[model samples]
Target: MILDVILDALLDTAKLIPFLFLTYLVMEYLEHKTKNKSKQIMQKSGHFGPLIGGVAGAFPQCGFSAAAASLYSGGVISAGTLLAIFLSTSDEMLPIFISESVAAGTILRILGLKVVLGAVSGSAIDVLWRFGGKKRREREEHNHIHREHHEKDIHDLCESEHCHCENGSIIKSAFLHTLQITVFIFLISLVIGFCVELVGSDKIGYFISTKPVVGVFLAALVGLIPNCASSVVITQLYLTGILGAGQMMAGLLVGAGVGILVLCRTNKGVKENLGLIGILYGTGVFWGILIEMLGIVL
Candidate 1:
């Protein structure tokens, strides 16, 4: 049984790769489009630029981190905007939407939630930044860096130093990144599937699926631990009727919410606004309960 569980975990992880790859492609395209727009807008007002920046950042699946990284390195966005987008966006939604047996209504609802959450969270960040009144210092620091970079560029003339490449290069990079990411996701999913089967959702999911209130709380907490594979199992249980939609969404919300917090801490040029995270989590639970109530009404 132990050996079987281990094998299952390995396979599930492998299964996640294809999905991750596909998400990478979509994210890359969104990233390019967003960057171009943000560049134009940031030229006008740096603070207002994050509104669009957060929305754009939310579209990509796996590459939000990479996109966020690149944007930060380029000094294109503020930490608040990056955090808002990270909290609002999720790559896992694509596969879930495409998967057979998953409800179209549920997928659409989740997608809609993504947009709302991204905008709301981003706006909150902007408000906080306004009150903090630290933008002047940040902008001055940014200008100094920009000036230094320009000066250095004039002094150090190296033809080979041009790191920015053509569209073809970006596309190729995105494609390869997607391919590797997809393969990795596929493996993770496959292993997760096997492990859930071995442990039986009834044994695990059952305990957590009770007490709507506590269930929702635990679902989010459990999602905090590493392992994307477990999400597959948790989501499957929900779809299969072993768990309720509310429970499933609760798990997803926690996973995405806490996941963003964790990433924000580890990542540079990113800091999450706690108020925004709370709203996202609260909204998730609200939606989850709404779905449950709908079942009774229908």
Candidate 2:
């Protein structure tokens, strides 16, 4: 059993390498091509970041969310954009639906709902962020100042991701970045997988009992397992007539693949990370309750 779990983790972690490498490669190219005023215009145009992220994230690939987290950590995208991708990402849901032979219309509805919600929610968060506290643009100013005179001791997420960004070859740097994050993800996934196995799947079901109100809340918690298993279980339960559409949506909304795990590992500030998680969980719970109240069938 342990060996099987280990192998599963290894294979799963391996899947992320190509995506990570590709994401880093794109970022490296942009880094080389864009600069100063060009960068500022890009950031300014990020008013639509959530929309872009939403569409991109709605695809079947889980790597998009991971890539978004890395981008947010590096200040390449706004937190709202990160939230949008994380919110829309369905992880294993797409494949499960296709394999289960679910109707194409039904699948599109689900995907469309996630995309719309993710885009709206992400934009809202960005608006709130701009008004509630310091704007991301203002913070970028600090990014330019030399380390010697900085007040905040925050480490650059780009540098923390890897020091290879300055290397001559973009491919080499991207590969190294991919390798580093892959190793980190493998170790983390291994530990998480072992713990999940130790706890047993039966316990997960028990926690999200059949009660509608209770299940809606607990399902979101279950959605946060940081592995593909959470999504598989949630989607299966929904199709089996165990979970309601609202409850399923709730779980799926929180099911951002390993995006949260990557965020926690890479992003600076414990409070900031926790805050993001809180927002994510709250979004899931809020929608779950609202959907249940409205009797909106998907």
Candidate 3:
């Protein structure tokens, strides 16, 4: 039974391998297009850009975390946008759409819900940030502005000897590197799926669903762990009918919102964007409730 579960999980991950590769390519292209644009512009024009990013991201089956990394590295999108992608997209949805777990109708409903929620959350963050900036500007105008010591240009400093490169070469390198990383991620996801089966996702899921408050806390905690491993457990919970759609969605949404936790840990500049992290968490919970309520009502 364990062997069969392992093999099935492996196959599922294999199916996502190509998707991960493609996501990297598309994200690279998006980075290319937005390269010269100001961060302020992305921050101000939050709705369309994030909505597009989320919807396009949701269509793919995997590697959003990798795409988030690429976006952060390229500086095309902010941490909030990355969280939006995570909140809304899922690989398990594709399989569930085809299997007995969730219908195509359910998948569509979920995707539509994701798009709306992602856009709204992103817009909310941007609006708050803009308001904060406006207040800061007002204060600076009224009071003497404090100046920090000038630092050397960041571009003059380099992380790697090969960090600087022509656009074409950089894009090609990012593509190849993303593909390689995704292949390994696929293997890891397969292994996680096998373990979930061995432990009995159904039993574990029931325990999670029985307590709403605990379930909410657990969802947030599970989200703190990086990678696709949590999805395996969550998906099983959904499939076995152990988890209500509300609880399962809450966990998954929370997982997506904090993806920048991984990005912030890895990148310094991204750490400055930690303010967006709270927005992601708040929005995740908000929509989680929304999803849960909707599931009950409809």
Candidate 4:
């Protein structure tokens, strides 16, 4: 059983490695090549910022979440845009589903749902904040000061001999990141497979399938775990029939991988981080229930 689980993980990881490597390689190269242009676009996006962030976040990569966090901290993007990125980010779910031969139609539906949810929710939040007299741009001066210090720190760090960005090794960095994430997925999937074997899929399904509300909430909580492992577990559960589409959607919606973690680290305020978590979990559960009510099956 253990050997079978290991083999399953290896097979799945092998199928995804190439796509993962290529995606990250392209993203890294773009980040390096179009840094100024990207910043200009982000800065001038205005009301369309969240929409852009959502689309970018839906690209099946977790690295965008970290980049979004950085942009938010630098005040180059609004909180709504950052939230949109977090909501739409699926981490390893899309690529994993593709590699597992999930239907392309189903994948499209999932992506479409995430993108719409993210854009609408993010825009609404921004509007509400504006009405509540909490203007995002009002903090520009503070953020500018913060950005200056932040840039200085980066400059000092890059001046050190250990920095690789100055050496034009972004591809190497992307390759290493891909390998790291693949190993993480393999380990998590192996554990999940073993647990399913030991506990039986029916039992696991019963636990998550009992009460719809509880299942949705539990799934959202699982998504809050700050690693790709949560996404792997959710995907595996769904594939094994241990979770329905609604439950899986809830988990994926909240599973921004390390996005929330990065936000907490970069934003310098615990209250803001907590608020983002609440919004993410609430939105995910709401959508989960809505999907269930609509009788949409994956």
Candidate 5:
């Protein structure tokens, strides 16, 4: 069982390489080439970030949430946008649904719901941030950094990731960065996989399935695992009639496809990270409970 867990973890981490590499490639290009225009646009379109993040994160790709974490750490995007991406990220849910031969319409509905909720939750966070005036200092700092030495800002991010490839060719830099994060992700996935194996998914499913009221909270907790297995377990439970739509979504919404892992490692400040996690957990539970109360079947 342990060996199988290791192998499966490796295999799952391997699947993320292409998307991760491509995301880094795009980041490199933006940093090296379109830094000016992209910065201008990113700032100008800041208000729409959550909406855009929701759309991008809802795609089948696994790296948007990870990339969003890096962007947020660099102060390139707001926390609301990061939360939006995390909430909407589908991780392994779509692939599992397709493999299980689930109805296409149902899949679409779930994806759509996630995207909408992601945007709504993100926008709300942003509003609260601005209303509380907590966003002023960060925005000013980001602007000052950009006005004086933008390249250093980008390099600072590279330093955070410990890639130090900022001075190299864009392709080389991107590759090194990708490899660094991929290794970190692999280690995390391996540990989580081994733990899950020990605890046993069957036992987990039975517990949550039997207790509907408590399941939302527990399901959201499961979603916070920061691995694909969270989605796999949640989806499997729902398909087996052990979890309803809202309960499955609670897990899925919190399953940000390793985004949480990246966020914790790359982003600074433990308290801030904890706060974001709290917000994300609250959002998932609120939506799940609301959906259940509405008796909305998907």
Candidate 6:
């Protein structure tokens, strides 16, 4: 069993590494080329900001989440856009699923649903906030100023040489990041596979598939963990048939890589971060239940 698990993980890793490396390389190159233009593009996206953010966030990397947080802090992007990025961010799941040989149709369906959910939820939040009266806006404005000053302080503390990465080669950075993620994924996959073997697929499925409401709640909470580890766990479970489509959706939707952590670190106060967490959790659970009701099976 141990040997089988190890071999399976190695095979999956082999399938993913090339794609992962190439994707990151392209992303890094694009980011380096468009760093300045991105801010202007995001600013001008306006009402379509959430859609644009959601699409960009679909890339299987946490870097976009951090970038989105920075843009939000700098007031270059709206709260809606930031949330959209958070909602749509899948961390390493996309690459893992593709590597696992999951059906392309299913992958597309899941991706489409996530992007739609992100756009709709983000737009709704923005609309609701608009009519939420002046007091909240005033407080938010105060927080924004504080966030800027706090960011400035952090920037001042860092040496100028360390602050800029313009001279760094995107290919080198992409290769490093890809290698890091691949190692992490392989380790997690081996552990998860071994555990699944011990626990039995039916037993695990019974836990999550029997009571979807509780499953979704638990899965969403797990997804809130601020690392790619959560994504690995969720994806492994789903691929093993331990989690149903609804449960998988709930967990993956809420698993926004390090987006929440970035929000907490960059935002002015705890209240805002807490609220965003609540929003993400609530949205994930709601959609999970809705999908369950629709009887969408993976």
Pick by lDDT: which candidate is best? 5
Return the TM-score for each candidate structure.
0.51, 0.89, 0.68, 0.65, 0.88, 0.65
Per-residue lDDT tens digits for candidate 1, residues 52-167, read: 64466455353453344334334355545654555445445457557755667766676556556555655665677566646755786888744332211110111122323233
TM-score-based ranking = 2, 5, 3, 4, 6, 1
lDDT of 6 by residue, 1-298 (tens): 7888888777755555665566556545546676556556655776898888888888887667766764564455777888888888888889898899999998888888888889888888777655663565578798874433232222221122142334568777656645655676567667756766787645544555556678988778777766565677778888887777888889888887655654665456577678778988998899888887898976
For model 3, the stretches where C-alpha displacement exceeds 4 angstroms are 1-46, 133-168, 175-207, 257-262, 270-278, 290-298
Q: Of 1 and 6, which scores higher on lDDT?
A: 6
Worst 10 residues of 4 by lDDT: 152-161
lDDT by residue (tens digit), candidate 4, 1-298: 7787788767756665665566546545546677656556655785998898889989887767766764565455777888788889988898789889999998999998898888888888777755653344457555763333232122222233243545568777567655655666667667756765777645545666677768988888778766666787788888877778889899888888666754665455577678778988898899988887787897
Candidate number that wins on TM-score, 5 or 6? 5
| lDDT of every model, 2 decimals | 0.50, 0.82, 0.55, 0.71, 0.83, 0.70
Q: Model 6: residues >4 Å from true position, as ranges? A: 1-44, 133-210
Identify the leading candidate in terms of TM-score.
Answer: 2
TM-score of decoy 2: 0.89
Residue-wise C-alpha lDDT for candidate 2, range 95-150, written one tens digit per residue: 99999999999999999999999999999999997676655545656787333322
**Order the candidates by lDDT, highest first — what do you get?**
5, 2, 4, 6, 3, 1
Q: Write the per-residue lDDT of candidate 3 for residues 1-298, one digit (tens) a residue.
A: 7666566655645554554446445544444455445455655665566676577557545456545644554455654466567667664545654665566677777667766776666656656765876787778768978645332121211232143423355456455554455455545555655666566656666657776656755654554344455665676676676666666666666555223433453345544545555565566666656556666521
Q: Scored by Cα lDDT, where does model 1 land?
A: 0.50
- Clashing residue pairs, backbone N/CA/C < 3 A, model 6: none
Q: State the displacement of the C-alpha of residue 202, model 4, in Å, after optimal TM-score superposition.
A: 10
